[model samples]
Target: MSNMEDEYDFSHPERGVAVIINNEAFSTPGQEESDDRAGSSHDAEALDTMFSGLGFEVHRYDNLTSSAMVETLTAIADMEIHSKSDCFACAILSHGGDDVIPDNTPGAVLLERQDYVLGVDSGVVLVASMISIFSDTRCPGLEGKPRLFFFQACRGTNMDPGVGVKVRKTKVNPDVGPPREGDGAEQTDHKDAEEGNVDIEDSNVETNYDSDIDNTDSIPLRPVLSVSPSNINKDILVMYATPPGFYAWRRDTGAWFTQSLRTILTPYNATYWSLTTLLTHVNKRVAVWYESSYPGDTSMNEKKQVPCITHMLTKDVYFRPKNMKHSTLV
Candidate 1:
């Protein structure tokens, strides 16, 4: 692991960019708010503060429609500034679900919604399509740079039924424990991140300008081959608020996952821990936070959640601020 860390350059690139797509209110005009997402803004603000403290230039988009989200991402992908940057961090905070799509024929298969996070304008946009625009094949400037994605949304409707434990309240220490060190190499799909964006469709937004072409007219077909390995987007990290097929817990103050993240990434803590170690701590903290808010239903009272992370990074990652020592304690 030490040898692996020695192989890469950790010099600060020109300027890193952090993009925050924050969706707070999810209702359009004439419709009641389907979801208020009470604490998303808190998450976004924390993320912005953290990334900015790490020297990233933050770009935030709030309450965007699905089409608007696509347009925004597309515009970012088309920008030529990535080469001048060292890394990119994207945080998406919104209402998400795996809504079922009914087949046209009866008794046919019901399809699960893929790659979309719900937009405020009641539109569903393909998250894959949006991110693919930044793929190495499409956006060459970002090649080899570390890309980070943080998603704070429910992956599904299923809730965890936590096992009963003896009730005992103790006076716990207010300070965080000393950070731990661990070596586990591998990256997550961020592909799931691509599949989680959902929004509504607007027929009025679609328009076509076309003319018939001659039958004799032929365009040469070219076959393109990919050199990269399958299911891998190298040098990227994806952190989800919850695992697939689970609900992400939240409070009026903010989401449990984001709060845990902020706590772990504090300057004092980050100086002593690697990103992987910090994330593991976050997962544990979130998993142990059992919710008991049901008024009369004990079955619904015990709920738990854990965060999911996918990374393709081949080197150690640290989040120390500028002028801080790069030598990691791990």
Candidate 2:
């Protein structure tokens, strides 16, 4: 076998590619502009720098509609680069909503499109369902390769009420309810207007249902390969900025969780830390920062948040600097 097939070395500049889907403004067709993710650009810049420092080629897409995001991922899954690479990574920054689609169908709470009620991006694409696009069969070159996904978005409408303390209280944001679409859809539908546009280019299709949704009333007699997570998500690692049903906190500079991620993955830190250990550190640090907040009367004290990670990695992973030679999974 060639050296490429024998071992995986992330230090090599061509060993992998990382894509960043940075959605700053969520202005879908016929919808008023959604709330601007004030500091997302900084978050994107930090991610680009962090990945580049680790020696991976980076591709960034901005202001994409749902269709564009899907097209981009589909195209990447078909790229020749994976055959020559050790791994792949994708980072998505957007607003998240509940699983209420236009047809009252349940979908992932990620990505918004026009007409708040309708699912776009060729239909409603759930966050959990995004992985199938890079299945071992669909993207053969990526089989057995690490696919890391980082998400910085809200998973639900609930906000952290923050623990009560003896300290003086600050003015809290009045419960304005969740964001919403212009047509008086539920507040949760507002989430559909953010991220990229849903069906700007692929506007012809009205309801692109997520593949996970089963329309049949009868059970299938034959077993499907992608039905189970273990079978299809072999070498994947997903890290969310916040736990399910929570809002991911971001400041003027960037997201506290991702910023902490940058610190833990840095060369100086990774030499001694494993990927599992690094994520633990990120979670703890983020929680502590949120709890601290602004001291004194104006403080939103005891607000707690935790990062969540799901992995199916068979071996341990330790990130190494570009110039350093380190252990690779067997």
Candidate 3:
């Protein structure tokens, strides 16, 4: 293991490779240029700058087809650089949604949902497919190393109409006694505790579902391995721009999630704070600081977005300062 007691090692000369896939234009047969993503280039550029500043070898790919996307990732996973690098990171900015297919069981009617990103040609690429390419058995060079992925796209067609917060001022009676066991107050406390536990477990659940896509072709299922590798998905992290069944907001300037990420994960912060700490800041910023403000569409106004982060890292991950020299491994 290259890591210390609780932290992943970043003492190698090469920090790692960072890949940015930006899909700004849609060339599907019936889709218009209006469907083209207007501000995705800004996201791509910002990620490139931010990752490059972190001592990564950044590779940027623009407007690739679904097949091309897979090929590109396959080539990267086959590279020898991972043996010497400390981690891997990838950011994808594109139109994305859920891939729904009708289950073909006799007298059964059901729709299966799979998450995917759109290629420029309107072809779909499953997010899971991309992650599987870097599994331990497939990309041995990155075994036990952190693999980070960031996705900026709409998860579904649902628009969030933020709930109004009402503040009620009430006077408390001085004669009121403290709540006893089995009272309303005690039940409320227990409920709160249960909710707190649910919140913690929510981070590990895969609840995100992308918005609708126009493609009619059925999405192929990933083949199940008869024997799964123990470390197949050991040290991976995936972050999405929005919660399940919600639209990710993007202005003409840039995407809400990417902007917050670049702002929060600066070199100074990266050196002192864990990656999860920085992402928590990013989540807070995106959820609180942004809201949809379309004047013509009242229903779309005041919408909120919250990013979701899931990780399976066995140790704390940190990005060292770019100028810092490699330290002797413990």
Candidate 4:
């Protein structure tokens, strides 16, 4: 067998592909954009450090639109790993509103088109689901393999009252409006790759549905795969940043939820621990860390968001590689 295929762990193998998406560029995307965009660089850095330590072959993409993300994810899923690889993992860092985020550039695209409500690349979930489908029939051995997705973006609209602790990444941003059609190009041309670069005005954005939607129906955009998480056999372990109708905390240090995942998966793969065990560690760490440090922050304190494990998986999984290198997170 080829070396690449030989590396894929269908049963108990070595190495895994780690896809990390960093939506916020800090200075590039800027702070004034949204509450979640702030400190995203820190989250990305943490993921990079953790995953690198664990010996994962990490691939990264940043500031992508719903369509661009679809292309990237499709390419990843289309890849044919060897019969030996056990699983795959992905980390998404972005400003998510009900499973989707506006295209990061926020230039001329405008809010209407920007509100694609995508989960896969918007924050984390959408990408995970796309990856999971590949393991379904295309990869017979991966039928029951583990697919881990870690999300650092907020899941709700509530804001954290985290105070006193100064985060360095937060900065000033100007309110920008969505660019008019053909603002950057010709007026006759409507939708094209160039139109993808339009400016968006999200400050005046409105919600078309209920505010307290559950994660099960969290995804906003119409996805290509219609299967619910309950039906899939591929084990998908989703570590959400917060509970339904609750906002996940992003500290000056970093996002509380993703940081916890990083801690659990760092230095080496969590091969010894099952999906449940790893999430347990994540749940405890984020809750404790935020409450203790922030102290008296009623909004964020005491918010111990549980890791929502949708049972599509048929087997146990450890996020990182087993014996190849030190444990890490991403």
User: What tens-digit string does per-residue lDDT give for candidate 4 at 1-330?
Assistant: 122232224335545667787765323254463323555576777787777666667888876656666667667666655245566667776655343334447474432122112333344334344545556665454455566666665444543342233333322121112334433321112121111111224333211221211111122333221112222344656556765334555544466666566656544324434556556666654543333223344443333344444445544544444533322322
Better-scoring candidate (TM-score), 3 or 4: 3
Q: Which candidate wins on TM-score?
A: 3
Q: Give the alpha-carbon lDDT of every model.
A: 0.60, 0.57, 0.69, 0.48
Candidate 1 per-residue C-alpha lDDT over 1-330 given as tens digits, one digit per residue, 9 for 90 to 100: 243354224455555778899888765567553456666787788777777766778999999988888888878877777877767778777776444444457786644344347677656655445556667887787887777777787666566775444333421122244534521111111111121111214322211212211010001122222121113378877787876556676655567777667655665555455667778887875665424244355554445677888888877665555565455434
Question: What's the TM for model 1?
Answer: 0.71
TM-score of each: 0.71, 0.64, 0.74, 0.57
Poorly placed runs, candidate 4 (over 4 Å): 1-13, 25-36, 99-135, 138-141, 158-233, 268-271, 292-307, 319-330
lDDT of 2 by residue, 1-330 (tens): 113233334543465889988776644577564355667787788888777866678998875666777788899889998877778888887665334223233774333321110022323345655677887888887888788888877554344654433322222211122233541321112111121112322223222222111010011122222211212288888887765555566655567666667755664444445566677777765654343233343333224577888888765655565556544412
After superposition, the stretches of candidate 1 with alpha carbons farther than 4 Å from their true spots are 1-8, 29-34, 99-115, 165-232, 290-292, 296-299, 325-330
Backbone clashes in candidate 2 total 7
Question: What's the ranking of the predictions by TM-score, best on top?
Answer: 3, 1, 2, 4
- Between candidates 1 and 2, the lDDT winner: 1
Give residue 209's error in model 4 in angstroms. 36
